[model samples]
Target: MSQSKPSFSDKKQITYYSRLTQLGIGEEILITLPELSGLMFTSTRHCRTLLGQMHEYGLIKWEPKVGRNQRSTLTLLYTLAELKAELAQNMITAGDYEKALSLIDNDKALFEKLLVHTSGTQMREGQLHIQLTYDRPFSSLLPHQPQRNSERFLLRQIYSCLTRCNRDGAVSDALAHHWIYDETNLVWKFFLRPGLSFHDGSEINAEVIVSLFKELQTRPPYIKELAHIQSISASGALCIQFELRRPDPGLAGLFADVRYSIQPISQLLSTTKAIGCGVFQIQEHSDEKLKLITNNQYHGYRAFTDSVTIWQVSRSKDYNPGEIEIRTGGLVSNQSSSCSSYLSAGKTNSGLSEQVHNRIEDGCLLGILNHRSHFTDSQLKKIRYLLFSNESLKNKLDQSLDYNIEGVLAYNLLPNWVKLSAITDNDTQLPKKISVALFNHKGLEGCAKAISSILADNGIECDINCYSFDEFYRRAFASTLSEDLLLTSVNFDDNRPTSVYCWLLSDPVLHQSLPQQQRRWLYQELEALSSITTPQNYLTQLEPIATTLVASHLLLPMFHHKQTLHFEGLLQGVKMSPWGWPELRDVWFEQ
Candidate 1:
């Protein structure tokens, strides 16, 4: 009788062969199925399936012990070429094969070819190695420019904000040791931590603080943040006082924005010479990569690793699983790739480890109706009811790819955190025809199709218009959006509802369209919320305002999406900020 050949999934074959090539001849390795599962981001059952196929193929002898501690062992029985042939047949990438071979031969050249750069500490101490991919090349390290999350991640490491928001969204001291608010005088007194110094060894004082604010007042984003500042003065040696135009309780939150990273006045003119009192100092920066070294002169906790190197790859597939990887949404796939470990944020489950899966509640998706468009108020209200009231439509839309329904479907502008009275359902007449504008991005086309189908079922004609992201932004800012409805997203920098309120009011286009009375009401509500000192009470004050806004039918809240991070087993003490960036100061490699 002829012997039959065993079959395996592409993931199983690649993982098995890769592991085999890493071992020396006659070297035995013991790996518990659970441990292997964690490493591969696979289920224990799937790991067993892979082992079964390996044994059937005569690739390894799987010995199972009857004890909990002694789980199973895999022994190599095939030559390197034989394993290579299997991997090639399974269609593993050339880069992956080279990575595996490099591990076997202990060759640094092949590994270097795959990575952008490897630091001396990483090479010598087997320290943490991280790989990141971005959609666009990094523009600037300057704080004034609008930055993506990747840029902010690097900035947080190399720069220091006056106040920092912890994982729980509470404000903590960074450059400033502590601060006080004088309600009577409408002023804030910030006391700098003594002995604070920049990377160049100059002591930080009230003059530096005042100078930074003066520079900030000249830039955008900060222009709005500093508009209420009546005057800023350096008091004593370490004290800097700011007199506000009004009594604002959320002033600390404003200082905590990542864009407010304090820099020396002397280095402000030189963009290349970016310097701050952060935990890490910039060793080198370019469009392709950023290299950082630990700051021994840091006043607070020091980074556990000596250096960090971030490379901007063009695509996620370029990421090597052998090193730590950071990626945004939509890059990971359903099938596991042996080339690298995976972490997914939001609603994606592609190769995500349960331990590393995180859900951030700060991101809110909105469906804003352009009051300037053709739709009338009644028509808009009816459309909102049709979309939000139908449970079936919500379920179908929730199942769409990359759509995370973890957050409550927003009926109003306020996030689910704020309690508000329920919106009473009323029967209304639907418009015969409706036009919706959606940005042409990944997964949104499917969403547009779903919405069209839903409206069609209700006997209404739906027109879905898709435009590129640039064109969409152009139309939005120009107030020339022809569609009655627009889909958009916004993220709050701080946990306070005041930030959300400010964002709603700051949009020049949106603000211009609001009626005079409504605009006055918005400013009045903002003042009320800003005066509340306690966060809980501030949230309480948001309910009435949110209820009034939702009744206006101007904005519809859809859902909130969370960001995720995946780390290799070698990384320890990893804590991510609320803004979805890893706090690297304490992250260390596990032995």
Candidate 2:
């Protein structure tokens, strides 16, 4: 019988595509007949036959862009048909036609190219941008998040411990794993999780625990919560004992303080790194942007996505424009009307909040104020009004003048109080100092009421000098140091209840027992030792110091902060921390 033109089976033709069979040229960037002949063993005559067969089957078409005009030849441009023919022809010259076919069949790179060509190259690049604002100039890793909830909301994967509070706002560990109460209810025993490690690769043991408390003592005075701690001794790697001289219902709440709880003391001490056992690790950080990568080593569940970035920006309805630029050692949060105007107009998406942008502008001008110079009536009234409304104005006061307004009813100092519970029940009145203190300058709601309630219940005079953040800090520093006063409220961002720092006035016995001298000293120390450079450790160190100083008051047992979040994907066993974020281990990606 005569051979039927050496035809290949339909199965073989389909297999070329289905099994990722490589087509076209290899070894030669620019495929020519010579290169193809070297690959295909069949003779040029057989190559011509294969090309005719492929052309008739419409396997490929000619490309004018890559083809050279061959006026003498019928084929103006070589198609895949010619390419395959050339491959076979080259194999024939080598005396191994079957081997050449086998080589194409096993070539992965060729297969990928075929797939890419067939799919038409569907690869693409994606990018994301975020906006953020900070009260202070965006310092390096100095943790100064407004609230634990805000921090947690922004950074989704940090470990946290939450406490359940009683109706009286007392931190109750009754349902906790191990609960014990002593005479004054001043001592607490906590069982630590086993196998916890710091980001610096240090084992979390009693020594680290002791060092943590010690570090807190040396930190800024604002964090005086841990001050009441006479000692913190870990019984084992997993157990610890905290001894206090007096009762404090707020102890459990202190754990919610973001400044107090992030781990890796060494990382906090290092200017280059601020380490935490969160779901994400810092991939890159600048004053205007923060980028994080998933931390595979996290004991908590994984984050919903692989990476996130935050951009530092300011937004405002006003004409102020802000400046964001990289400075030596860190990025500078500079705000000016010119920059704010651009950002607000939506012409420049710098990603800053209006409050933050304005604060920078206000701070820049306030920083240059000279109280010593003679002031015009308008200037003096403005200064007096600002100072009278917010104690922070004291920072701008002339150093030569002693016209200090102490214990004066600067104003009614009344704040509209709101209960944190589902329903307002057994509500306590609030004072002005705490009310003004809690005002969220970034248009944060409920701060005034929250602080007012806490102060009202504490039986202390209600008072505060409500000012912008930078102005508040500058003036508060002056007042806190020279005025011999300590401002106390539910620890900000610690997820502690306002009642923990408030509500002590009702308990006369507890208030009388507290040592005023110690409290004064603690306050002075915080104001004296405060520094913007090390704001993270400074904030972290405040908890223990504050606790130690106020322990005798037996105030709010544990501060309580509540967080509620919304998610679209499967998130399993999510636990909310004081920082207002979810624990990674507690959260699982269902999809």
Best lDDT goes to which candidate? 1
TM-score of candidate 1 on Cα atoms, chains taken together: 0.65
**Which lDDT tens digits does candidate 1 get at residues 1-591?**
002364443554656556545654445668787776666567878877777777777677787655666657767766765554443322212224344444335433333334422111132235443434333345567655444334656677788877866423367788888989999999998888888888888888999889888887875445555788989999998999999997787677667766677887766566666887888888877775676788998878888866666655443442222223443233433322212223322122245343463554454556667665656666766766766544654576656543433335555554555433334335656777778786753334545666777888888898989886557756655668767777665555544444455465455434544556776788677666676643435545665676676667666666554455454434467665545556666666534
Query: What overall lDDT goes with each candidate model?
Result: 0.59, 0.36
Candidate 2 lDDT tens digits, 19-81: 211443222133444333334555545544554554454443322122342211223223444
Error in Å for residue 416 of model 2: 6.7
For model 1, where is the 10-residue window of minimal lDDT?
116-125
- Candidate 2: which stretches are off by over 4 Å? 1-138, 144-179, 313-475, 478-591
Query: What lDDT is obtained when candidate 2 is compared to the true structure?
Result: 0.36
Task: Look at candidate 2 and tell me the lDDT of residue 286.
Answer: 68
